[model samples]
Target chain A: MIAEKLVQTYKVSFDQNNQELALAGSMRPQRAAEMADCVKLLETSLASIRGTFYVNVKRLVRLNNVAFHSLAGALLKAAEERPDIKITIITSSVIGWSTKKFGTLTAKNPKIVVEEYDSEFYPGQAFLEEGGFVPVLRTQTKLTWKHERAILPRHGLEPGMTMADICCGIGDFAVLVAKEFSPSRIVALDHSKSSLAYARQVASEFDIGGIEYIYGDAAEMLLEDGQFDFVSCRHALQIFNKPEMIVNELVRICKPGGRVYVTNEKISQCLGEPRGPSIEWTYEQLSKLFADFDMDLEFGPKSYQALQRAGLEDLRIESFMVTNRDGDAQAFADMIMAWEEMFAGGMSEKRGDDAAFVEKFRRGFEDHIAAALHPGGYAGWPVWVASGRKPR
Target chain B: MDLGAGQTEAGEFTLLLEFDMDMAGFTSNWSYCDRLSTYFARMISHNRSDSLLYSNLFSSALNELLETVYRLHAPTGSFVCSVSRNGAKDRIALTIPVDTETEGFYRDAVVVLNGGDVSPRYHNALFSDGPLQPNIGLLELAVDYAACFSIEPADGNAIRLIAELTLEASAP
Candidate 1:
């Protein structure tokens, strides 16, 4: 059986690594049998439709890692036994090699392959390997932490204050607010289930209380009227298809004397020139949309007269530049390499030889990351962190 | 259950039961209430079961008391009630009325109701001998009587009753 073959190979190659000669020299019949047994166990377990089993094993030969093969084979066996059980195999480094060497096990049952990846390439693949949860991105982590630090002073967050966080991706900021402010209740709303799952996991791991994770589109979530002392969003307003509807929802949930904080990164400039036309067009549309809701937008020094025109009281705007200088140069190189891979993928798909475009993007991204880390890059790609407060 | 009228400076005031009496009867009749009391006593004597039912019944009673306050207080114009569940206890604290006359009435009623099963806790101090000075301590007594009236059935009827009560109280 394929399951037996997988276990035999797994036992034999358990300690095998990248060295081809060592792997060739270590191959033995007895070791193969042990690997087969391991595969059999996995296959048998998967064949049963009851419980869920997860195994983490590393140090398999690059091409024929038995753990990956056994998991794949077991998934196939499980599907054959009962097609309803959901099986997810998340590999970080060797998935591509396994798929290529073993042939696609998910071909017969496409749904069984929830996702497959090589973690070394997909930085986000770290999430799947770590039980399908990833720590918030470092930049996002810092942003959230800074927002937490600014909450009490900027928004007057205090214990027993009811608060709502809209577009709360993974609820990192929401968890911080729940823990630090000890709000009477903190409703963390997100549109993505994956994000909400991570948020729930973080809340559970930290034993943070008084936070309710709500899943749905933020604009459509039926929030209780006048229930929150403050409604907040972090760096999510721009991506909202209907920014105006979201703004209105924020205001609707806020109490009569409550405040609404909209935190967003404004891309006003690109590549040391005025931002691309597309970016400006998007913002203009956004400005017009918000105007319909009587919101006064305060963009950097070129503050819109519409803010005053909309009769917004206490309108304020601030800008800050974030740079990643403390990290090693290799990190910058790795980032550049990742972007190169992305460009390569797109270029390859189009069958176009755009090596010059690839080089330009690589150089730009590398310089940007490096400069931002260096004092010289501080002014480049400056992020506008602006917030406005709604009147009581 | 009848809640007796009490003398207040404003005038005579009466306590009204807000839940559907007919629904309460359908769930727990008077005879079944006696049976529950007997079974509970026996169960306690034998140590055969945990007192989860007692705890659940107490929680249900408290929820009902708060729900009544949330509904009637606003309508009567005495005080406002905002029912929030994320707090430590299932209870309602009436925001103190600014008017001295109204505050006096509310405080006296709460003081009288202190230490009862549904004891009233005053948000503000009460004036002695005020027009609203009917002992709210009686409110707690009323809850106890209502708790005793709750009956248990052979099936999962008690759980269903609690669910129904919770739904009624939490309905916006």
Candidate 2:
């Protein structure tokens, strides 16, 4: 009878894509017969199964109102029968229709939950320029021991050595490195006092000691010259208004024979974007802003040029391709959110709420990443760690 | 068996599936495509009389060719599958839009089809020597499925791969 119903209406069948059950094909006419038939098929298939079921309807292009109801009913019935089963339906946040429809459908069923993901959904609150640091526009930090182990060894930080982390926005990298590298004292400075307070709280929570969190201008720190055995800045160089002045401070604070490491990621180099309406324009504005700061756009392996220009020796520059296996799209989405905040007038003037801007760039990122990682996708970005020793 | 004057047309018929190639992702999960081709072959072969041994071999051959295509390409472009009929013969074509470099590489392959092997010689100003690595998928179709296939350049950085399968008429 269900097969007969499918014959009368549109064809729908289930296929397995890894852990998820993918239901593909079109559903039209919005008739109850077709809806009932689909429900019956789902019930039969799910009655014997237990535990969580991840059903993805992304491939199903069209579904009538009644079909949504039928799907909801079938999912609810399955959940009620098992009592332990959890049903999660992943959908696009941009589609208002699906949001409302799925919302209404899952309203009564406690077991059924609809999860919406959009690359542009900035999780953190957007804060306008405060000490040249904005928390809302920040991407997830690479602060793990793996990233630390990559850059810290070159510095040869002894246990009693002092280090300075200038422009330490949230102090994540500095804290992680301080704990792992066993430095005697590490002073982390940032322009944003609020960010410094938060970073201090995080450091205290981690019980990391022998560190001081200071709120000050990096380019004009009062610290004595050659006081720090090692000086490093991670990822926040491009945001500085005068990177050259700050680099001078980084060099000034470092002792002779001590190491100065300036590492940054070239976002554009790693995250390829497919040409879309707003992609070129958004990046163009960001580039202009970066130019104003004298920040090198190509800041990875080529970063040594800046340090070399500052008169550092034994310069070693290594560029790595850091693949985003777990959260590639989300990280890129956050990057767009940051750009949107940084250029609010330019971005919002074109599209209010940054949804359109986010969607265009986010989709471009997804598509580019998909194509790059296709046939099988290892999504990644380029990270350059350039370290040079001060003249001995 | 009464074979009436069959209809022969030149124009195209219906299009089947259109898929985008994600080469990196597919390199690891290639079995999915293999399974898909076999499933599609079974679906298309339904309700057809398989009195001749070649019919079963033909379906298997088509599945093999589809799987081979899945393994070779990076799957970054659009893959279009369309079908057209000429009298008793049905031709299924899979067209993929590829970059110029890839198209050049494809042009130099040594292909074996219909139990006969042929190496297509190409004369290019850039590289006087012809390319290598035969289009093995096409060769399998010709050998096992008794199908005639060809790989030729299409519009705007794309190549067309077409295979013709002739079906025997049933008893009247």
- What are the Cα lDDT values of the candidates? 0.40, 0.54
- Which candidate has the highest TM-score of all? 1
Best by lDDT: 2
Q: Write the per-residue lDDT of candidate 2 for residues A312-339, one digit (tens) a residue.
A: 9998887766554443554544544455
lDDT of 2 by residue, B1-172 (tens): 1111223343644333233344444345534333434334333432232211122333344544454455445346555554455545666665665666556544543243433543221101111222212353454345323577678766655787777776433200
- For residues A1-392, write the lDDT of model 1, one tens digit per residue: 01121121223222113211111111112112434665665555544434333332212222212223334455566667774565543322221122222224444455454332322322322222243223323234453365346644464456788888887777778877776677886777765545666776777788775576764445644444677887776655554434566666776777866666655544334222122343233334334433443332323333222233323356555554332443443343343334334433442224344666445434544444454345443322233433345566
Per-residue lDDT tens digits of candidate 1, residues B86-168?
22122222232233443344444444443344422321111112222232222422432222211112121111111111211
TM-score of chain B of 1: 0.25
Interface RMSD of each candidate, angstroms, one decimal = 30.8, 29.9
- The deviation in Å at residue A248 for candidate 1 is 0.6
Model 1 ranges off by over 4 Å:
A1-138, A268-312, A325-355, A373-381, A385-392, B1-172
